[model samples]
Target: MENPIFKDMLVLELASVLAGPSVGQFFAELGANVLKIENAATNGDVTRNWKLTTEPADTDIPAYFCAANWGKKSLALNFKEKEELQQLYKLVQQADVVIASYKPGDAEKLAVDYETLRSINPRLIYGHITGYGAADDRAGYDAVVQAESGFMYLNGEPGGGPVKMPVALMDILTAHQLKEGLLVALLRRERTGEGQLVEVSLLQAAVSALANQATNYLVAGQEPKRMGSDHPNIVPYGSVYTCKCGKQLVLAIGDDRQFRKLCTILGAEGMAAIPAYATNYSRVQHRQEVNERLSQLIGQQDREGLLQQLQAQHVPAGAIYTIPEVFAQPQAQEMLLRNGDAKPGVRQIAFKVQHQEQAQLTPPPSYNNYKEDKID
Candidate 1:
């Protein structure tokens, strides 16, 4: 699991919370030396205090903080202090990258601006994340961005109120965008022996993720509506049906062939012959009727057996699984990352390289103190 692809790389992280730290962890997983710089004035990253009710009150390093803070060295410094500022300058000399999440004018005020750091190290790649954009200094939270980006409006049930996703999806998406930008920047530097600034904003990332949903609005003027576990374009694709065992199954019938096969499997070939449900377009137009018929047919059989039969017939169908059920599977268990006695975490890197069986994840950094012993 030891892929030292970035073993010689040095990342100086001045970012806090998820997006910036998540990028740091990505490099750390690649065997880079990541130095996480937190502000002493604020008692370090606020996420350190974002503990669940079940967590111990006396602890500063909560589960939320550890989520994206592993495999890095931490430093809490008052940047205004001359000595503390000098420490950062020294790291800049040897750092390959600097990750920051400062507001519009705050970076300049704190002297950690990209212009200032790039002046010290011209070849240093600066990755910056913002809530809105450079023009706006409004603080960005994932929940707020989710609402503003049209995600919340399209989520949840058909008639239900807007609902923010359970996870910090915007931050995660922004981190991924920043990572792709940084990687491309690194590739550009390799070719030209130069470095540049890479920027990502939460609002932009969430909007970018709208993908086809945005296109449907722009191209066809079809305003997206909330349809729980349902797709706008494809019928039977995300439609959930309950079985006799009370278990749920969902179908992803992508083509006419699959739809016909689904009908054959459910002993309802007659339904597919009915001119209205003949094609995907017709099925979409008659969504209610199709769903009701499928519900009745599926309800006559057990979920597990029906799912197996559908798969055997090349029909895309699966059973709904709870979070516990998800991790209980072998493939999910294999994605778990464990370092010492820390609670199990899942790896962010999903794709595998040739001959790469696992990832080498280290322990999360100490909340604020610098661990000189951890330095190689």
Candidate 2:
């Protein structure tokens, strides 16, 4: 296997929870030496205490903490202490990159703001994550941002109360944005020999993620509504059909050709010839009628046979799977990782990169797991 891309890079992670630490985790996976700094006064990252299951007999580390913090060293310090603050400053001086997720003015209060640290190390790439905009002082948790950014308003069934996504989608999207920005900054620093500040907010990320839904309202003057599992623009694209055996399958008929194939398979050649459903645009205009016809036809067929026939006909279709069913697939097994054979062992990184040696998975540390070594 080849060596990792960022073997010699050093990252100082002053982040907690999901978004900021996730960026550090990405660097760590690429073989960067990431030192995660947590405040000793607060028992380290808040996620360390966010227990999903009861504390195991062997480890007090929460699964939430483990998910985003692996393959990194931990240094816990009280910033209020003169000695510890000095030590942290020294670490900043040696780092190639620094990432933090503090509410509005908290970074300056702790003396870890980008401007202060940049003065110490001119070539240091700094990344800042916020809940709202850089100047907004409101707390920017994922759910709140989702609600504020119009994401929640577009979610859930028609005529039902808005529902927040079960996952921290805004945080995850922000992490990706931060990761991309930092990588670009790192590349630019190599050429210019000067680092820059990169910033991402949960609100910004949520808004950008609006994609076509946002465009529908802005460009077409069509405000979107909750359509449950259906896509706003595409007809039959997000509808889940129940088979005779009670299994659910989702169809994604992208074009007229795929629609015609689907119609042929369902013995609805006459439906396919109808002018109202002849093209994707027309079908979208008559989505209820199209969906009703497809649902009635598909509901009579067995899922496995229907899916096999759909695949053979080049129609995009898939069975709706539960979480366990998804994990049971070979593709999913290849993506998931486990540290050891123990029952509640460390959940390894869920992504993979080809042609690189797998990094050794490290369990998330307890508070102040590593003592500060004097920086030269």
Report the number of the highest-TM-score candidate.
1
Candidate lDDT (C-alpha), each: 0.89, 0.85
Ten-residue stretch with the least lDDT total in model 2 = 342-351
Per-residue lDDT for 1-376 in model 1, tens only? 5457788899989998898999998888777888889889998888888999999997877898888987877888899999989888988988899999988999999899999998999999999999999999998999999999999999899889999998999999999999999999999999998989998899999999999899999998999899988899999899889999999988999999999999999899888889899999999999999999999999999888888899999999988999999999999997777887878876677666774434366677766668573346
lDDT of 1 at 72: 78
Candidate 1 displacement at residue 306 in angstroms: 1.0
Full-model lDDT, candidate 2:
0.85
Kindly report which residue stretches of model 2 are placed more than 4 angstroms away from their true locations once superposed: 53-59, 342-355, 372-376
Candidate 1 Cα misplacement greater than 4 A, ranges: 1-3, 355-359
lDDT of 2 by residue, 1-376 (tens): 9888888788999999999988888887788888889888997888877885567644546777777887678898888899989888998878999999988899899888999999999999999999887889987888888899988988899989999998899999999999989989999998999989999999998899999998999999999999999987888898999999999999988888998999899888888899999988998899899899899999999999999999999999999999889878987777554566622322235656789886665656666777657321
Task: Give candidate 1's TM-score.
Answer: 0.96
